[model samples]
Target: MSELYKKSLKQIRDLLANREVSVTEVVRACIERINTTNKQLNSLVYVAAEQALEQAEKMDKEGPQPDRALWGVPIAVKDCICTKDLPTTCCSRMLADFVPFYDAYVVERLKVNGAIVIGKTNMDEFAMGSSTESSYFGITKNPWNTKLIPGGSSGGSAVSVAAAQCFGALGTDTGGSVRQPASMCGCVGVKPTYGRVSRFGAIGFASSLDQVGLFASTTEDSAILLEAIAGLDERDSTCSTRPIEAYSQGLTGDLKGVKIGLPKEFWQAGGIASEVLGEAEKAIDAARALGAEIVDVDMPHIPLSVAAYYIIAPAEASTNLSKFDGARYGFRAEGVETLDELYEQSRTQGFGDEVKRRIMLGTYVLSSGYYDAYYKKASQVRRLIQQDYLAALQKCDLLLAPISPVTAWEIGKHSGDPLKNYLMDIFTVSLNLAGLPGVAIPAGLGVESGMPVGVQLLGRAFDEHNLLKAAHRLEQAIPSIGSPKL
Candidate 1:
């Protein structure tokens, strides 16, 4: 097999721009890599080999287009993002055979910029679980150690980039889905500020929290991809009308005069693994050595993030998923005698255990008498968490924190305990709740587990340019975790 698939997205872009490698060769190399490794990793649920090759050959004949930023690049999309004529199952039996008739805003943007839709990747059912194990398609294995998990629900997207199955992949970050997986898989994952990226065709898990994110091997490559897809879209009313920044142009690799705040709430929180904390400390030291100022900032309400997020996210999920009844296009149950039976039976048979659990919890919270006590209280707490972030950002240009409390664990380590999985997202949920942009860059390998550890840089809403610039500079200062042996 060709080693072309091992190159970074930027490297491949340059190669294609210079006519050093044909688009056909690059796409073929990636397809071959996916075929060889996906059986073991289970990263991609669908591989569009024929369609991708056809598009690549057409692009090869047309030559590179200067106006298109991603000219000839091959990228993967998480299964939840709608792609015309492709399965957008969300990795649940509920949408098993359903294919979207239209492309998502990001997919349309990527195609316009010359990116090939390589395939659809596996994900947690309806983006509800912290681990990809909840997918009906089967769990995605960590590339570093097959027995361990790849943090999710965006595990497959992170694994695809880490294992070089594709140059870059798009994933959704709703309460840590993208960043946590990137941390475990040793990849750069970016979740733009909410409304910064259009959510037009992304299947809603939590309407208020979900935002499309991307994963790549390096921060610069992430910046490139972000610039290609971000901007206003009339199709999504919530998408910001603010001008998009030239994200890649901001990468000067200079952290001079940059102030990075370390939150006391995040660092002092108990239960953080020793090795993970050590790696994060090393990253702080690296930033200090690079002419950056480090300061301590306090965010008292941040500790309540996970609690607030679970309530608000699932409540929105309950409202959004009500459309999946058997009456519509998705998976419909057979042998249903009554309309009520069809609704109940189709849902019972379609959704997995985790999805059903969240739906019930969501319905309960949004119920008549409990609404004021549960969902309403959670909304108030969410506001306080957002206030904490806004106040902290005023003290520093950006905040630096650990992406997850621990490294990837054994596949079934928390199988029987769902709360254990929820608690692991303590560090990442705040970003989604606050609608802030964050970038998770590999810090180093854990001493005990030998798995990847990542540090996230959180910035104010709509400040992705500065966030990506800081992440790129800090990324250079830290030691590379290197590629997975897979």
Candidate 2:
């Protein structure tokens, strides 16, 4: 049999059932892979090798659990997701040394499904930046080209999967964090419909928009991981009580009658590259070959989504970050004479510039006189954006678009201009505001850049299963096009 690195969940489960390889060996192979590749990519922030082995020993000696698909499989997590034993830093100095007493609901679900937590990968500080440059820990370089960025927030998670540091990983998506980075690194990631996955214990960025996502090397791997972790939880008020389906079963379902719409406005955007446009056209052609009807759709209000997202996301961010004011939790000043000084000093010292900027912007937008002018208008615009998507869905089963205008860009290319970095998230944020599901899959390799370009598929609220199926079919239609330097 081939090494575990090349096998998917199906292969692993069969091996575990037959006892071809011990659970300990499977997890050990994962750890060894991390140790080998993480040095070059720096994707993993903390590796729980000992803990994984201990869990594996228990599973092997005792026996695998029944009905749990992920039993003994290895998984990594974005640093923003809290793990009982690991530090949930959000890649910020404020919580640099802080550890949570409990696990995030997603983490707990994965554990219950018998998955092994390999480690916590790096991310943007408080999930705030686009290029991962805003992370206090340091930026996660693109797996395709080390000089380029791996997108933001979930950057580390994408690189980890592409590097084969772990079989799969859990990431958070607010403004395309999961899908963008997954595209940048040539991996597959899905942002579930907002309330499909419980968010209890996940560090908040934008309360209404925040969601846990998944990263894997293939659609089947991603679906298997998502199946284990997705579902409603009473603990999270936002979690939906709807039944979760078998995400893996229909990923390869026939696309004969599937209707996928391509928004004309998305491709016509000024920033989209020619190679990217060609690749997306080819993906549509391949889907057509599979009998999917490609219809031209219009989302007239799509252009304004970025502006509205910037205002509302920051508004939510400001209020959420107010909890980290030095005295309550996280960092505290060493030499403060007064209580107010301690709160102000520690926060100012611990938070990175981008975080502080967003906080200030958020506070300003929601401020006394400015509230009606900026925040209120943005809220109205947010509604319009959601309506745009809702209306578009009436014409087609799902909408298709590009994840990013370009492939992985050089790390320092946009670092000098903070606004440039923020613009990178423009295409991704509106879906978060609407609480819709989006999936990123490798479509083709860029001709000029020789990197991967991702195609995004969006579905109606809570229609992740449909979204996954569309992306999975397109991915299979394309050949071995992605080649991230994992």
Candidate 3:
């Protein structure tokens, strides 16, 4: 085996660019790693080994293109992102056999940049649930400890990078899916500000909150991937027209004169494990030592983030998922009579429990007469949360916060307790509501469980340049969390 899978994205890119390794060698190493580790982790639902090798051989013959930033690199895409001629099941039975005719904007960008798509990773079905257990494809275990969860929705994408199955992977973040999983898997996760990356062909769980994100083992690798996929796309009306920055060029690894704020509410909020808090504190102290000023800021609406996010996210989910009723495409129920029966049976049989729970909750909130009391109120609270972020950013260049209240927990620890799982998202959901950019970096291991703990650095909307710079600097200062034993 080549062991090329162990290299970071940049190293792989360099080797290919220098003609030190053929693209086929790199792709094969990744496929071998996936074959070895994926059974236990369940990180990938579909491995495009033959397709990737064919692409790699062609790339080798054509030679590297200087203009393509990711030339010859092998990367994975989450199951929810559409890839032409490839299965994009979203880890849900509803779309189990669904394959789009056209690539998603991000996937198109990846192809244009000469990157090889290696596989489609597992995720929470329709990107619901805080843990990856909700996927119909079966749970994705944490590589650090097979008994623990790797975090929701984007868990497989995070695990793919953490376990060296691939150099990087694309994921979607709707209320902390990317960052939470990265935290648990001990990898770098970047959730750009909403609209910074197009959502054109990504299957939506919450239209308003969803944004495409990426996972890598290092901050530099994350910046490189983000730069490749981020830009204006006329196909997506919500995507910003602002010019994309050379995010990788901003990595000077210096944080002098930067101001980072700590929200008082986050620290005061109950139930944060001591080890998690300790790691966050150590990160803040390290920032101060790096010549960044640490200041206290207040966001009173922070406490309402979880409640408001659930109502708002679910409401949007209900509307977005209505198209999966078996009337047009996707999985249709057999032996169904009448239109209503087909719709009912298809949805009932296709969606997982978590997806159904959110759909019902969403439908209830958006139903006549109840919309104002539930959906409308939650929207109002969401705006207040956004205002809170806006106000806090005024006092500092960025905000430092915990990614999750605790390290990765044992599998089935919160089984049968969805509320406990929802609460696990308390530290992450607010960033989505605020539409801000955030990068989750490993803050070292938990003192008690010895699992990874992560801290996030949040920047104002569309300000990923500064956000990555600060995160890169801090990443250098913190001790490496070391790769998982897998």
Candidate 4:
């Protein structure tokens, strides 16, 4: 990777602001790096080389302003987020020819702040799968070890940052999509509080669960990006009207007097690999050494999180995705005459297997006969899960846990059993269910594959400042793992 690609967004921004490097050089270097490595990693599905260059030249001609947070920085956005010109395929045939006429709120923020959108990264179809293999565009490979799978559905976004294809990227995290992929890729990924970031333009999988997430080289970079994109948007009713905090100012790395909650459920969860657990321990020890107090907290209802999440998310997904019927937009079956047949044939042909599976499961749960028994029950359980975290947080500032039970697994490791893939999400789905903020940072290398293992720091709703501060503190103690050689 070129040194230009290796630099953080902050570093790149500073260089561009000072005219130390032209915006054209920075963007062209990023595109060149993506071209060289993307064939192997399959991280980026689309590259708007001409448009990005055009923007770069425009930015170069107009001198950078001191007030813009991300002036002249190059960033990649996940394919699921709506981009005005770039094809937002979501790595699925369902939206193969789809292109939004306007940008997603986050994309609009990036552009207005002078950040260049190099391209759209790949992702699971409609953000439904834990591995990127479910995408119609083909699987995205782990940069650490090509044979291993990069966790999804934000796998491409993670790989783009890890491989230095872009300084940072935007991804949507419905469950652990952003954090899991960041963990496997050894980068920093953060999902803000549910309504903290506007969701106006992103293609929805599960409307209640989805949030625009940030992937960056460090927590501080994530904070900078988050600060720029997070705020009230009149377009999205779900977006919080609360005043946005200055998140970057909170990164003092002073853990003094901070209480870190260690949940019993996370550590005792079955199938948590020993190496990942050990890395979590090291992070706890590092926090303790920095004057933070570790407290034992109980979240008895956490085991029910995955069960509730699957029900709630899929149900929302079914409703949100219902608009894609042949009559509106996206793919439409050519030969179908009847409306029902067109809807059936288009969906059957447009969607991949994983997407269809979730849609069916969602449809079943929402069916009249089973609605109360399944979806209603799951909704009730979800409230309990949220309450569990609320109660636990009362005793501590934030919760600490392993991002995943294991490191990146080999491709096709759990392909035979869909339930096994769901099991992998046990640690992550709960946070989304609770509508809290969680940041995943690399703890260290694991014992088995020598790949990166990450730990999550989850905080209260709308309190991403605390999570980013704690994460940045822990990040300073751990050695930086450089970009993988392709």
Candidate 5:
């Protein structure tokens, strides 16, 4: 493996700018890394070696341009994110051969800024499961321990960065998919504020909750990628019109006068592991040592977050995914004599168990009679969750909490019981429910398994700037465990 594989996104950009390394070198190094490790980790669903190297060669001929923020950086995108020519299968048999015609908004931005898309990382089938095991392509093993599972649906994205296959990768967070996976893989993952980045070409998981997420080795990389992709998009109605922040630069790593909030409800919440909580407390102390005040706040409705998220997300997914009926595109079942049978046979054959389960749950909740009872009730609860976050954010600069209930679990530990896996997301789903920005930073190693433990800092809408700052400070105070040696 080349040393270039281990460089941070910022380092790669600087090297490219100074002509210390050619764009082809960086892209080839990453492709080589992916080729070397991807077999065991199953991180990448597709590797665009020829395309990436070709693009890098073109960039080398053109020379470096100071104006391009991510010029010549090699990055992998989650398979869920559309790449114009590459397959965007979402790791599902349903879209086994689905290659999109246009790039996702984030992908377009990366290309425009001269970032080479090395490949598409694996993900849960339609981004439904807590573990990447749900991916039709196969589970993505944790780089820290191949026996352990990488959290999903962005497990491959997290693993790609953690294993040094790429400087950074794009993931989507519907309910902690990005942050939780980053935490498990011991990398920096940021789920931007809901409208901070557009969702134009991302295959919808939960339309309202899904947001393009960033994964990198350092917080600065997260900030840089976020800046490169975030902004108003005429293509997406949900995208905000707010001006993008200069997130990569001007990061002081000082938290003086910053008020970090610890929600009482989070402390009292069920399922959070002791090590995870300890990590969050240590982060709090670290912030205090940096002159940031710690304040206790209440998010009374947080306990209902997971319940509400499942209902709302699945409901939206049921509706959003209805278009994949096998008639228009993607995998279509043969020998279907009628349209109804075709729809039934195609979906049954195309979708994995987890995807079917969610679709059924979603369809049931949205069904006429239950819509008023389940869907409406969940919507109201979702509002309360949002209000809880809004109220808590008013009391502090940002909210501090664990990214997941526990560290990465051994693969197949919860495979038999999907509900047990959902419980793993207790700490993460609430942020998505509230539509808030969150950055998960690796805090320490687990006592039992020596796996990575992460604590997240949640901020108000469009407050990624400060969230990254506080996270950087915590990162500095609490030493990282470093990358896994594959």
Candidate 6:
């Protein structure tokens, strides 16, 4: 039954339905794996052992329902995404004891689709860092090599899926959080279009950029989950009223006549790692072999994405986090004389260094005197970047690039420089600004490190179907790309 952990959600459902393996055994296996490896990697912040076993016990007695797509598969939640009974801290002390009153929209959908909740995964504190090293809970090590860092801020969710602690996991992506970690961990992860999935209960980072993302071993699994979660939501005003597509329905489909765009600017770079670039080129060649028409395209303003993301993401974060001042909710300070003291002390005491740093940065950019110089300039750059993508899409069906410049770096290798770590996210952040759909599918493992390398496929806004179909085609072409070493 060791093969159980490597099977896709579709395959898992089939095995359980045929009574070849029980849901109880599946849940038990995942629990055992988590117990064995979690201490080494710190992938999971909380394990829902009792809840998982109870749910599995119930499923074991009841025969599988044909309509339930993920019936019996266990999945973990990124701590930032609210779960009904689990603490949603976003991996920081500021909200250490905070439990949600309601599940995030994606979590609720997962439960209704019959996926058992396994645990909550760790993340960078308030989703600020590219490496999980910024997490207050400590860095999440790469599954391939324990010394290397898993990419963040969705590091724990990616680690959980890669480690087989769960069949798949849910994460939130503001910039490269989900895609970058999935790339580093040798897993397939998807970041849906902005507002594709409702963000009702997720702790806000960047109001406009944050979107719920998912991790799996194959494009098929990611597509299945995307279908269930993507839809119009009354809870999120920013959520589009556009109809959600069947992201999995077109699998086993070839990319014949599909136009794939390779952004020329992405290749000519000082920030890119040579090995990562070579793997991406190999992936593109394989896709080309499968009847895809490759064209060189450009998103000129993409270079400014990093600066724009840092400004906008934090600007929104500062305001969203203002609610955590120990006044009415969340973690409160032990002793304070006045309301002002309570607010300051509670925040100062509860927040981690990274969280405080981002808050200060956010406040600085949004301050009256600096507002035009920082926030407004970032907004203008964001518009140009989105326009760049829109123009490129006019020339192609879908766009392709690397999710991250390099494979997982050694944990803490980037100790003193936040700018260096932030630059690793350069390639993935533009899509967030463009409000487009993107997926990071494992291309192959690195030569020396043998860590995973992923190529990102992006689609026009709300056009997830095109992205998934292309991903499914390329995944089949790639070899030994699924199943993390962990």
Tell me the tens digit of each residue's lDDT in model 4 across 1-486.
Answer: 256887888888888889999989999899889889999999999998999999889988988877988988989999999999789998889899999899999999998888889989989888988889888888999999999989999999999999999999999999999999999999999999999999999999998899999899899999999999998998999999999888888687579999999999998887889989887788899899989999989999899888888888889988888888877888998988899999999998888888888889999999999999999999999889899999989989999998889999989999868888998999999999988999999988887778889999999999898889889988998777666777
Model 1: clashing residue pairs?
Answer: none
lDDT by residue (tens digit), candidate 1, 284-336: 99999988899999999988988888888888988999998989778789999
Better of 3 and 5 by TM-score: 3
Residue-wise C-alpha lDDT for candidate 2, range 172-197, written one tens digit per residue: 99999999988888889999998999
Candidate 5 local lDDT, 1-486, one digit each (tens) = 258987889989999999999999998888888889999999999999999889889989999998999999989999989999899999999998999999999999998888999889999899898789999898899999999889998999999999999999999999999999999999999999999999999999898899999999999899999999998899999999989989877776578888888898887777677777776677788888999988889888888887888889889999898998999997799998999999999999999999889999999999989998889999899899899899888888998888888888888899878778877778889888888999999988887778998888999999899889888877888877977988
Q: Looking at model 6, report the run of 10 residues with the lowest lDDT sum.
A: 477-486
lDDT of each: 0.93, 0.86, 0.92, 0.90, 0.90, 0.87
TM-score of each prediction: 0.99, 0.97, 0.99, 0.98, 0.98, 0.97
lDDT of 1: 0.93
Residue 430 displacement (Å), model 6: 0.7
- Model 6: residues with Cα > 4 Å off, grouped in runs: 1-3, 482-486
TM value for model 5: 0.98
Report the alpha-carbon TM-score of model 4 versus the true structure: 0.98
Tell me how candidate 3 scores on lDDT: 0.92
Candidate 3 residue-wise lDDT, 324-414, digit = tens:
9998888799999899999999999998888899999999999999999999999999999999999999989999999899898888899
Steric collisions counted per model: 0, 0, 0, 0, 0, 0
lDDT score of residue 286 within candidate 1? 92
Residue 481 local lDDT, model 2: 67
Residue 76 Cα positional deviation in candidate 4, in Å, after optimal superposition = 0.4
